[model samples]
Target: MSSLNTNTNIKSEIDIRKKANYKTEGSDNIRTKKQKKYVLIDGHVYDFLKRSFDIIFAIMFLMIASPVMLVVAFLIKLEDGGPIVHARICIGKNNREYKMYKFRSMIPNADQMFQLFTPEQMERYKVGAKFDDDPRLTRVGKFIRRISIDELPQLFSVVRNDMSVIGPRPVIEREAAAYGENRNKLLSVKPGITGWWQVNGRSDCAYLSDEAKNLQLYYVDHRSMGLDIKILLKTFKVVFYGKGAR
Candidate 1:
């Protein structure tokens, strides 16, 4: 009996040693992987700089556009009796939800009408599919959207840190859900009021069919302060000329 007890003790000690060795090796491997995981551009310093730029741009844009914003609000209400701006839930960085504001381009209660007309609406919306002569649009809304002024309200969102002036456009939660692996890259930056897709021509571009990959990959590989400025200038030209519009 004593011999058997000794044998059991030896086996238990061996098992404990094996487990300890495994844990040590496993922990070391985990540490090594963590060390190798981060890319240089995505390091802590780059993140801090990126955030600083976003904040600075947000503040200045809000200040500069304040007067224009008030004028837009007044015109919207003057043309028709409805809310000056529209707000909807938009997905942000990290799959977070925030209310996004835009100039109201559709009639009141259009949200309710959306379900009934979705299939029919697809035929109407072309070049990213829009009803060129949508009955729901008010006179002021038409003018506002033509010049892309309808998007000006989102400067407030940029200031609020709910959005960026230049990132990929925010997808709705439903859109985000369909993203799958794309969401990982898409949600890395805050959604922008204007983006690669916007400047490339929202009106001329295909929907998720053709343009999504161009915008998505461009955003992932080539995002920079200079790129954002370039896109803004391009947007100005597009809006001014009324080229490729809905």
Candidate 2:
């Protein structure tokens, strides 16, 4: 009788353990489903169309802007004989690192000029990695930045499939921390030369602020062809007015 009792006790303990394991698995499945709700799934058709548009836009713009690019290159060379393009290591789609090119807009070795920053400038840089009245900007750099001309070189990146014409602007690896939990979602799509945030408020929205994170996530969540066209149209207005340019 005692043996039967011991056997019954063991069976009860095993049943309890099985129930606990089942509950744990159920909770995990629930959490996984919740995460899936946030995952962006750009269908194959959308991807193809977006890529086609990016290529067409980049080729046409490069042709039209070739002369302007040459002139800008000459001015940059004349100013300091430094590299005409500045390549920044930025976080791209799927958290890959890529060199994002821009017209060199600062003095050569500008990345190593942190020691020259005032305490105030250092604080500003910590916030957004940029500030007005930057001491590092050359004269041509200042003009190009103000007119958004420095960004023109990113067209090549678009052609290379490293970027899109419209998407979230790529952030440096350090800046990716600003997106917090949504960082993966932000990197799910290729970064862009212009984006929802760029046309909305650009530099006026502090990079580390909640507003900037929300704007970037909103684009990731709601990206569509219509919305892309809308952003492209608004970009012209923003660039023309130099809104939020520094």
Candidate 3:
């Protein structure tokens, strides 16, 4: 948070410098050079709508998928003989840590063997990245993950007010910590099970990078009810088409 404040101040300084430079050039440049403040234009109405949508949509899905979730839960136990659901902490709004739930998709000891993989593999696993041929995934896990049937359990989290239906994907706290200066803005909103990254091009958390600050910044700066609906509509396409699978 301290770093974010410092970075914000630095940007403010840079904007001031750019305005001064524009003055020496021409009057036409002045209008274009005005500093854009980060203000969420929609305010309380947007927040209310975002929450209402999360709750209404989550409840609706849970009702429709109750049978499928039950079947998937049973299949998980029969496949690997472990807990049917998996839960772990992810950084959310204001970078607060909260437990997120998903149907168990890997071996019970999946975390124990994670260190054996190279740096390339570490990101994917930590950020809930599951490969199509990932051996750690049980047979049932593959099917659920492919259709994102595995993520249905998170409706409970949305019900509990710990997550959003649309926003940036939740990341591990360490992953947030690794962001250094950019973490605060990213953490300002609740993490979602699906968001622009998934809809735009990303599939998993293991691929996070510090240089993605622009994308992260865009999310906070431009998030709106209309944009949220657009993202949600796009997410449906990703889920049905298995957009991120490899």
Candidate closest to the true structure, highest TM-score: 2
Residue pairs in candidate 2 whose N, alpha carbon or C atoms collide under 3 angstroms: none
Q: Rank the candidate models, highest lDDT first.
A: 2, 3, 1
Candidate 2 lDDT, tens digit per residue, 1-246? 999999999999999999999999999999898777545344666888999999999999999999999999999999999999999999999999888999999999998998889998998887784667899999999999888999999999999999999999788988897787888999999998899989886888877777877888889999989999999999999989998987
lDDT of each: 0.76, 0.90, 0.78
TM-score, structure 2 vs. true: 0.81
Task: Give a tens-digit lDDT track for model 3, residues 92-147.
Answer: 88767788999998888877866657776665665545566565677888888888
Estimate, for each residue in 98-127, the C-alpha lDDT of model 1 and write its tens digit.
999888988887666655455666565422
Model 2 misplaced stretches (Cα beyond 4 Å): 1-42
Model 2 weakest 10-residue run by lDDT: 36-45
Clashes of each: 4, 0, 3
Order of quality (TM-score): 2, 3, 1
TM-score of each: 0.74, 0.81, 0.76
